[model samples]
Target: MAESLGSNEVTFRLSRCRQSVPRSRAALHAVLGGWGVDQDVLESAELMLSELVTNALRVRVPNDRQVGVRIARLLEDGLLRLEVSDAGSGRPEVRAPGDDETGGRGLLLVEALAHRWGVEKRAGGIGKTVWAELKAPDIVAEPVGREVAAVMVRPGQQVRAWGKWRAVRTVRTESYAAGGLAIVLGLGEGPALRVHAAEPLTVRDDSVPSARERGEGTPG
Candidate 1:
């Protein structure tokens, strides 16, 4: 079961089992999606949450002990915090796994992806909590017509490509005599896609204003 700690916080107690990891991630996705968190940030948060929960499950705890998962959205700071607690002793540490080694890299991934992360002794005095924070931007999907300027496209934004929404990783501009300017977006997956400045592309606008909107000239 999950508990609503406050308007912006929810906590879940999961059994010390492997399935709990995915369950915790689903709960996180539901809560954050309801809050209209940006998709990119939500995805990152989910991955970090999974890693933390997995680490908690690995702790040498009694069978009756359950893993504690807490997710809080700090709107004032535009951050999403994920915490995993368990009634176990040792703290998690990041490690560099060798080429032949297949495991022990979970914390390393968390360290690289999270904006910041740390471990603290649990308030109960018997366990520890590993937590991570990610910069989360509130975003709403808006239908953008084909007339959107090519210069307006930016990385970290999502575009409707190949019949589905894909995150834009890179944006490039090419000028041609016939097309004037074309926007080539390097998506998070698959191949790059090219769209004309006036082509229809659905985009989700982020809370942060784009450079052009902020009076800074379009990025080259």
Candidate 2:
């Protein structure tokens, strides 16, 4: 079970298995939910933590040792600090992942999501700690604008943009600044657009695209 260490800190001791990722996310959901965190920030934090904890659990640890997950909510600073520690020796870093890579693309995701992040040695000299900070008051994505710039749209799908429904020409994840997915709309003829995926939109029957967009993060 997760425990609240104080007014703004929470910690969880995770088992040595793949299930720990979602389990830890549930723990964070519970703690952050109670603290009135913004829905967007909460979800982004969960995604980032999923990546960090998954990275932490990947490295080999000592016999019977488990990963350590800690969260510190700096409300005054408007930042939520998260740390994942393991007894492994390797450190986490960001690098361009190959197109055929199946996994191990988490560092890139972290660089795109968190406000800032880095690695440091643990206190007991056993292993290193990978940490990230997420800013609060996350942008609540609302339907506040139509005719968004052709570049700030999802690719490979039809969207209500550019003053009409258009199919996205080409799309790729992690192609935008700040870690959201990017797609080239106007059937690959126009400039790239910035986009974040929001809730599943309810489009009328005639408005739906043949192939809808999908990804780990969001579309514009």
Candidate 3:
């Protein structure tokens, strides 16, 4: 049985390191529902946990040993924490991989999405614990957080602001199709309007047109 920390916190220890990533992620989504974490956070957390736990297993522990994942919600404080620990001694360092390098971007992604992240010295100096945290969405903020809202734009949709921080913004795309475009907000640096893979598109700028336009779209 997994250990429970108060009503909101859950810690699971797995003897089989292989199960650490998937189990921790599922536990987060399953248990932390009412806390109002966004899907992007959840997905990023999953990938982060996978990388962290995998590093602990492959780099630190012997093949036979295991790792632990702790998921806790500080309800009053509005913080969600994920901790992954293994019985290995060395701490992880973030390295900038070369352009041709294939695999070392895990911690990079974690650093980008997580509001804060760090590693701590475990008791007895035997090993270390890596943790990442995300702040719960402030519902009272000015920008009304909504699910994907799709809008079509004519040629002149003004590009006043173009990023994720804004409550409202504008996006444009090359072609149209039925259910062809979904304006995915809260994506990395900006709101994204995603056209389904099958749609035809023409490119003018170095970057793709923001598929999901958040601002008012004038009729063509």
Candidate 4:
């Protein structure tokens, strides 16, 4: 089961097994993706999350004690935080493994990819939580103010259809005879709509400029 800790945070528990690694990664992707996280930062966060969950599974914890995972987006700091808690003793450290070794490089990769990372003792001292933070890019808000061709509509934007504005969930292109092309917009709550390249569609616009567009750097 998953729980929403806050508007910007989510927490979930996973069984202490290999499958939890991918499950945690997917969960992070969904959360971050929904938050409009940049593609590069999203991928890095997924990798770090996978490593953390895998390490948590390695610890000798009771079978009934599931691993805890928490993901949060720090808006003030523009950072993505990933935490994996296991009910086992000992802190994990970066290791320099020989090239011939099959494993033992998880923390090493985490250190290289993450902006910063460390281990923390869980509340009540039952186990430790491995945490990492990465510099997250500013979310790209959907553009507005002008109607564009149907082919120009991108996923995550809202389009007018069926007497109401619906969120565009996906965009696909289809080719027809004599090199004719059509754009297919899949709505979040209804059937897909097809339109020509020159069809005009309204989308939600960004009323405020983003930090990057304003020449501001990401927060530390």
* For every candidate, C-alpha RMSD to the true structure in Å: 12.2, 17.5, 14.9, 9.1
Model 1: residue 63 alpha-carbon error in angstroms = 1.3
- Clash list (residue pairs), candidate 1: 146-198, 146-199, 146-200
On lDDT, the candidate that comes out on top is: 4
lDDT of 4: 0.81
lDDT tens readout by residue for model 3, 48-95: 777777777666467665677787765455566788887787778788
1-220 per-residue lDDT for model 4 (tens digits): 6798856899999997778888887788878766667667888888889888988898887798989999887877878889899899987878999989999989999999999999989976599999999987575333344578888888877787875567788899998666778899988888999887777877763233444556666565
**Candidate 2 total steric clashes:** 11
TM-score of each: 0.63, 0.61, 0.56, 0.67
Off by over 4 Å in 1: 139-220
Off by over 4 Å in 2: 138-220
lDDT score at residue 97, model 3, on the 0-100 scale: 99
Q: Please write out the lDDT profile of model 2 over residues 1-220, one tens digit for every residue.
A: 7777866788878988888999999888887765556667788899999999998878877647888899888856778888998888877778787889788789899889999999989867588889999987422212222444334444444555454444566655445566654443334345554455432322222222111122213445
TM-score of 2: 0.61
Candidate number of the best TM-score: 4
Candidates' C-alpha lDDT: 0.79, 0.69, 0.58, 0.81
Which one wins by TM-score: 2 or 3?
Answer: 2
Ordered by TM-score, highest first, the candidates read: 4, 1, 2, 3
The order by descending lDDT is: 4, 1, 2, 3
